[model samples]
Target: MRLGTRGPHNPSYVWRSLQSTKELIKKGARKRIGSGCQTKIWGDPWLPDQVNPCIESVCSQGLESSTVSSLRSAVDGSWDIDIIQDLFSERDQRLILSIPLSRQECDDNWMWANERFGVYSVKSGYNLQTNVSDTSPNSPSINWKFVWRLGIPAKVRNFIWRVLSSCLPTMQAFLTLRVEVNNCCPICHNLPEDDFHALVSCPWARSVWNISSIGSYFNSSCTFADWWINITHRRNQNDVELATAILWCLWQNRNDVVWNGKCKSATAIFDSAQTLYSQWKMTRKLHSPQINTEQQTMQERWIKPPE
Candidate 1:
């Protein structure tokens, strides 16, 4: 289908929607042609629908003079092999030769190749998007690489992501869900047990940060996510890693207080984070693929997004 250009007033919205529609059509549409007049033998997707973009062959330098109409005789929809052999590779020629011509005498039309009976529906469109996001083999977010590839255990990485994303079941989150729970910080009882209160602003959490080297970074102009973004953007891998470990340790100690009312002191929290970081370093040294362990330590580890 022909798509309209962007509107003058909301050009970005129009352009982005138009571009995404083009991508969907490129992924989902295929031709059903009565005659070969409208399809290109080279650039267009007139081939069979097994491939996503039904064009099966690439001619990087460009194809020799060819068109789908050039593959058939005018009087009858029969293959004319001479031109096909001259322009296409043997495999492409065979692939083209395999396609049966339409007998219904209909005009060329496009249909969704991914849907049953070649029909499109809003449900089908939604399902196509759902597949792209969750079920497709290649759909994992590149952002996840920063979380999953950390040198900590898988559970720890997941917990770190929850805290960063504010997905943790902090007391404030429970209240937002309308679940019956106390709002005050269970450890300090000074504020709502929101992510910031539980992780950074509570008296207990503040003491943990104060004892840590990152205490200098704990300032007034910071939200939990602002601090997290700042930590992730720093050029030093050591700082990123240390921040991760410290946050993880802080959250763990907070849980200890909330669940058991017995948690580590600020000094003990810092010491635990240091111990975790050191063990990770020593373990990497033990399993080093390089001949020099020091070289691996010098190598950058964090795969942060460009600022």
Candidate 2:
């Protein structure tokens, strides 16, 4: 939604947005107790868990109207363990007991339990919208780190990330956005243009990968994301470098066909990839003596803004 004059909000849009927010809060949110007046003791997230900040209680036996303060010390602002044990199960009681109560006198607040500090922020709000489960070791960002850690240039890794996220100006992406563009592959026109077709399935893309270091590891029929993850996460350093370079070259070749009417052979694509791979490797060797192999990196990562 576009920002308007900072006066009144559109009622209909605001209501719909709040409804969606309520749904997310139900899934995760931690209520940090203060005065405990604003939160429902049994309803809102008042308990803490490691993976999730807030836990929900379904035992709505009789305490619908009670506030969290009803279970804590009104004089010293501490949680009463007996009260919690009486109302909740042993598991919940332990979880609720672990939360360190605040000492300063203030109003009760809804904190984003998923974050480091309990305070809410836009980044935390955006994170709540993702479907990717961090519980998996094979999660997208985790594998993406492997790609980024490869000796390739940061820009190429960034481009690959964009490609995986489907942010490239692929023909199918335009068509999906109702941009009135043809969906056929811009390079080959053999299949509908998408990340997979443009980078892997097209006749030219297949030719490039056939002779590269990643030769025959993936076929044209493999899904782009699955193949990408398999390469970056599973393959060795040399193969990872070759795969990244080939995909980058393929994308550039696609652009050439789209804008410059220049189509390169598979051999030419392979040469381009190899040249880039060598250059990046040599550059890294010349500049950095020791490699920084930490999961966190100095390389800038792209994150989509909040919708």
Candidate 3:
């Protein structure tokens, strides 16, 4: 449905509710150009850029109602370079030229911009909604490329991101959100619960780290992001994986203490992390393609027997 269309004078509750979601749909949906006949050059979200798909260049006086097809050559059905250069800004011209035109005749289509497959899924929608709403000023400057590239489970990586972003449901975070709750650390009961305190400075967390392999490598950074950067930079990949697993398990233990009133000892937590990391490595090894060592050995020995 068109977002700009007006509803009935006395719209039903369901109709109004559905209308409210149009803005969300608008945020995630974009026109996939094919024939480019029906798509508006200025208004439609047809550009290939991920950050801002719609064209940003100011429309010329008479070009307000121009369709994407107007910018194309009628003879070859390709973009008219001279017209494009004259009508759009340099950035817009580059983006417009980059979008490949389909050789065969096809209708323009709509696709979800958030997903690689151009199809909408509830998970992607939920992530988009959360990302849009997460405009907290206290959000930390995290190395998102490093975070996403961690050789760990997706859930663990997501947890690490939430922690670094200050989006975790720690007591201090709740206080920042104006959520009235005890701001004291559940594990320590001394300091305010925050990303750094809960994950790094807590007595229990410190104990867990002290007993772990990467404890000596820990750097004294004031913030969680800085701390993580230091650790990731200094440690090897295997050490980082172990450390991440431990952190994940440590967080899980903290969560259990918060929700279930159950707490495991620091040694138990460390052991759990070791177990988790070992299991994950084993699973990866199992799934990876195997080489026929015997066949390679025989081939190596077969020194071209005189045919």
The lDDT leader among the candidates is: 3
Runs in model 1 lying further than 4 Å from the true structure: 1-149, 216-221, 291-307
Q: Assess the local accuracy of residue 56 in candidate 1 as a C-alpha lDDT between 0 and 100.
A: 51
Instruction: For candidate 2, report its TM-score.
Output: 0.67
Which candidate do you rate higher for lDDT, 2 or 3? 3
Q: Sort every candidate by TM-score, greatest first.
A: 2, 3, 1
- What local lDDT score does residue 268 receive in model 3, on the 0 to 100 scale? 98
Could you tell me the lDDT of residue 169 within candidate 2? Answer: 80
| Candidate 2 residue 225 C-alpha distance from true site, Å | 3.8
Report every candidate's CA lDDT: 0.69, 0.72, 0.83
TM-scores of the candidates are 0.48, 0.67, 0.54
lDDT of 1 by residue, 1-307 (tens): 2633444553454454465577666667777655776666666666664553345565535544455666787666688888677666766877778888875555667778778898987778755655665555633332445656667756677777776555788989877655679888888887788887777777787787778766634466455665665556653667667767887888888788878988788889889989998887798788877567787579677888899
| Alpha-carbon runs more than 4 Å astray in model 3 | 1-30, 34-38, 48-56, 61-66, 69-86, 89-107, 111-184, 190-192, 216-221, 264-296, 300-307
Pick the winner on TM-score between candidates 2 and 3: 2
Q: How far out, in Å, is residue 254 in model 2? A: 1.9
Model 1, position 200, has a per-residue lDDT of 78
Q: How many clashes show up in model 2?
A: 0
Query: Which is the better candidate, 1 or 3, if ranked by TM-score?
Result: 3
Model 3 agreement with the true structure over 131-215: per-residue lDDT tens digits = 7655446444445667777678889888887876567888987776556799999988998988888887788999988998687
